[model samples]
Target: ARVAGFGPDTVLLMVLPLAHNYNLGSPGMLGAIAAGGHMVIAPRGDASTVFSLVENERVTCIPAAVPLVVNWLNDPALDRFDTRSLTLVQNGGARLSPELRDRLRKRLGCQYQEVYGTAEGLLNLTRLNDDDEKILTSSGAPICDDDEIKVVDEDGREVADGERGELVTRGPYTIAGYYNAPAINARAFTADGFYRMGDIVVKRGRYVWADGRKGDLINRGGEKINIDEVENLMLKHPALHSVALVAMPDPVYGERACAFGVLRAGATLTFEELSRFLLEQGIAKFKLPERLEIVPEFPVSGAGKILRRTLREIIEAKLAAERSQSAGPRRGP
Candidate 1:
């Protein structure tokens, strides 16, 4: 409608990948069209182009990823654009760190909302009304509104509040069965019908909080270490640039924590230094990595995710050689 000279409120801007649910401008445009609103599609979204569209088109709402929104707020060219027209800005994709979320809320003065969803089925959203604490703490409540969420243990019973368990959700709109795959359907659903999310969640008050995936949890001996917590804490180190924590097979402990990370330019760091730092910060010794691999760069997927599975394979191969060399030749006579 902007192309046809429609009013400002009639426009909605999408800055994410069009193929993504957040940016495709499908459901968002649907609401806009019903209200006679216009949808402005950004073929390629960047900090410069996005803010320009917001100012020129008077775009009121934007559904974007957290990293993109952070880039916009920190952009040196922010003064060049007039974004007073923006009322709602939503962010998703990954777990938004508490520090970044607070900066966006307090420093940037934007209405920051957090959303949690999977490409397949389950979707949850955190309302804007919640304080920054809630926004960063919980992944928010179920989006289905009336959906039932239960955190269950191996015995298939609901665990007590704050205890971690596999998340099982049941709702009307939830996908009842996988399409054209009996094998998936068999493992994806519970005997009683709730969808097995595979990811773990904890109940805090009334909200169900995501604890990453079930398989991703690192078991160091008898202790279970949350990789997200460790990764978040590692990122707090000033010398560190990026970090990905993956479980490496261990003979004595079943599986141990291994962190693959990059350091800031011209900054020299060591596993010894990191171990002391984490211990000083009150992180448990078991959670401190048994091995730290310093890499120049991480291997990221097309979607910009650090492929942990790939990284694990590389780490395994390197460690195997080290162990074999230490053991020496069996040898002899």
Candidate 2:
């Protein structure tokens, strides 16, 4: 509210899940009511409905995660709607791709801001006025002025700027320790009293860009989906020796889970069968694998740890090829 250009007339529309940490979906509703501006709630995020709400309600601002924005941009129906009232779009939770950011900025004629935050009390934001490169490239600086951050190696020693390390933070609002797990608490906090974020980050210029978390958790729509837990269930397929879960680029969900695996010799099973097998396990629908590929082997490094990022790249390349072929023009007229 104290921002120069923002005022009582700013209408905020929120469609993110209300229960998720980033939800503040309704907090915007409260802000709108206090400022005497209309608050619009989108129970579910659909492109057509969102565009309609924007036009009908003259929505001036939108709070969304990267996935929602990607889906909206890809939807062909977006061209049929009017969204001129949209002036500002706030994207947070995960990194927004440059392609998506440019599409929204050019097509929507709005300023886009990228924010990085965690339910655990870490927050960073890229200003709207920042260059498109920075907005798309970096997570920007700390939100609160007093927030202090450091990137440290395994020994708890600070690393030089531009080097990748685990991000540890100290701030007034930062959590001091885990609630009841003393074991987790000991590892999650440093002896020097900084909360060990376990997030990989790098310093470039004056901003910090979050790479990914140290733990192999799949961040889908702000919800932490444990990959190992899911992979264990997938291996029960009998035809599969072992499986590794990797995140694939998703225009709608920010990232969707994809499984890469080695099938048992002489075993022939379709993806549908594998999916049904997982469904029977009663995992949350969102946690189910959206795409699955059978590979001869899993990539392993010198230390024998699975190279998940390498597998993710291989799956992404295959998916991209399929999409490109599908979108390719029809044959000779």
Candidate 3:
């Protein structure tokens, strides 16, 4: 309640699934109860229902995903309802793109806050009064002074500020162990107790910036490309609506980056055009995507995060089919 600026009069609109910890526990239910505020649960997360509820309930805050905010901004029915009561829109469950952040504030006339947390530990959050650059660039500082966060290299040694490494944390609210998976817990937590977040982060003083998940790293001939960085760059293009970068199987390079994107309505973007744009942006040649697939939409999880694993599988299957077809049928000896 204190960190998120919740108050006794705050009417929080809960649109995320109740099963997720971000919604059922911290920030959503806990924040409201701690602040002595009211919560209106929506049956569905559709923009129409969410907007109408906000108008009717006079909701002061809402915990939403970035994609939902984008949908709301693009929905033609947005002007039909009154959303003047909304003061705070907190985003979680995924990295909120800088493009989306700017659009949210410009179109909604509300304060945008980004919360970086996991099911195991609720971590950083942007303050209400933070400057635009801090809100748009970094994921804010730790939730509390007591929350211990560290960015460490593979050897478990702390890295310098602005250097990317795995982020680990242990705090008052951080969970100690899994329910019944002892073996998994042994691998998940450090010997000292900090939960290994598996996210690559760069810290500067109090603030931290997420690069991508450690498991999501694309090792194209050991170049080590971060998929999140590529996606963020792709979002800057005016013709692209959404993008997801995944590792595709490469015979020589081991694994190459493949970008799947959704183009803006009635607009078009080709692989050559995107590659040229990345070159113009000063992106390193090694980090450029070797393949690009334009799609109508991305596969999303229940929490509204892009399902990169699913996209990788889709591309892998397509590649396998192509190879099989290329290898013509053999004749009897």
lDDT of 3 by residue, 101-218 (tens): 8888877789988888787775688888899988887787887898888888998888998898988899998899899999999988888998999999898888888887887999
Tell me the tens digit of each residue's lDDT in model 2 across 32-90.
Answer: 56666666787567788888888889988887765467557656778887888888786
Backbone clashes under 3 angstroms, per model? 1, 0, 0
**Candidate 1 wrongly placed segments (more than 4 Å):** 1-15, 22-89, 302-304, 321-333
Q: What TM-score would you give candidate 3 relative to the actual structure?
A: 0.94
Which one wins on lDDT? 3
lDDT of 1 by residue, 240-281 (tens): 766778999999999999988877667777899888888888
TM-score of each: 0.81, 0.63, 0.94
lDDT of 2 at 49: 88
Error of 2 at 222 (Å): 29
